[model samples]
Target: MSKVRKVTDKILEAVSIFILGIMTVLVVYQVVTRYVFNSPSSWSEAVVTYGFIWLAMFCGAYVFGKRDHMAMTFILDKFKGKAKVAVEMINEFLILLFAVGVLLVGGYFGALKQMTQADSILPISMGVIYIAIPAAGICMLIYFICNEWDLVQRLKGMKEKEKEEE
Candidate 1:
């Protein structure tokens, strides 16, 4: 079980890192060619732009996994017992729903639109750019699920403790 979880985490981390690395390399290569070689290919700009879309989405998912997704702790710290649990669950569920909606509806339509369009500079299909939305949404959903499960267990434990005190 531990091994499986580790593998999953590594996969998510690697993919996020790889997307960011590609973006950096592409931009750097483009700059070098335009300035040093004195002739930059038009395709380089398109590749860099598309790579950035993937990088930003993946980075958002990475933030969720790390539990560093800009949360407000003061409000949560003030609540105790079932109230806290409910608030936490609701927050997680809302996030999960949003990710699922984007992954399913927005992603589907976006991919369709992309496939139909002709990219101005690159001969590559636009589907490549739109696919990142769904891919990152899935990753964000996975992180939400994992984090929600852990929170639910803690909430249950807190309830049990409060009952014992009463």
Candidate 2:
């Protein structure tokens, strides 16, 4: 599980970096073309917009996998032992449900609906941009499964330690 998580982390990191780099270059090009050449590059602008969407979605999933997403942990900080593990598990389950119901299912339908629509500047279907939603959802699901497994292992270890202490 850890190996799988590590590979996924590297892959997502690489993709996010690549997208950022491309977007940066495109933005620079857009600025140069507009200011230096006195003409704006419409295609670059469209590409950068789509790239930013992909970057944001992928990076969000990556952050979730790293367990680095923002949260108000004041309530969580009060839990102890098995209760803490249980609460964490429940929280993860809720997030997993949201990823499935909203990001996966809803995103799929949204992308499908956009498939028939073409972007004004880009030569591709609008679905191409929306597809990132479901892709990130899939990444989130994988990370959730890995997280749940880790929590179960931790809970079992805690139980074993308690028995030893007794």
Candidate 3:
């Protein structure tokens, strides 16, 4: 189980990096070709745009896995007892709910796009581009669940400590 967690995180990290790399390469290549070569491939813009979309999704999931989402921790820090725990659980539940929505709606819509091909430069199925949305959502959901479980364990341990002290 521990090994699987490490592998899953590393996979997410690597995918984010891969998407970033592709985005950089595509953007740089497009700029160089358009400016330096005096001619641009018509496909460059679409490819770069799609690459950016994928990068954004992958990086979003990766950051979520890291528990680095921007939040005002100060107020949360003051929380205690059931209120603190309940609030925290609600926060996590909302995020989980969003992820589930993404997985359901995004996945279904993405499948629909897969059947429709883009009419523009790339001329590929829209599915290729939109699939990332649902995929990232699922990834975020998995990470969030793992995070909640870890937190529960810690909270249980704390409770144990409190009882022992009493």
> Alpha carbon lDDT of residue 139, candidate 1?
76
TM-scores, all models, native as reference: 0.84, 0.98, 0.86
1 or 3, greater by lDDT = 1
lDDT of 3 by residue, 1-166 (tens): 3465577689877876787777678788888899999888668778778878877877777777777889877877899865676677778888888887866476758668685777467778888778888888877877877777767876888889889999
Q: How far is candidate 2 from the true structure (C-alpha RMSD, Å)?
A: 0.7
How does each model score on lDDT?
0.78, 0.95, 0.77
lDDT of 2 by residue, 70-150 (tens): 988898999999999999999999999999999999999999999999999989999989999999999999999999999
In candidate 3, what residue range of length 10 has the lowest lDDT sum? 1-10
Candidate 1 yields a Cα-based lDDT of 0.78
Q: Which candidate wins on TM-score? A: 2
Candidate 3 wrong stretches, greater than 4 Å: 1-4
What's the true lDDT of residue 162 in model 1?
Answer: 84
Candidate structures ordered by lDDT, highest first: 2, 1, 3
Which candidate ranks first by lDDT, i.e. highest?
A: 2
Assess the local accuracy of residue 91 in candidate 1 as a C-alpha lDDT between 0 and 100.
80
lDDT of 1 by residue, 1-166 (tens): 3344455578877886887778678888988999999989678778877877877787777687667789987988888777887788888888778888977568867988889787888886788778888887877777777777778788889878888999
Which segments of model 2 are wrong by more than 4 Å?
none
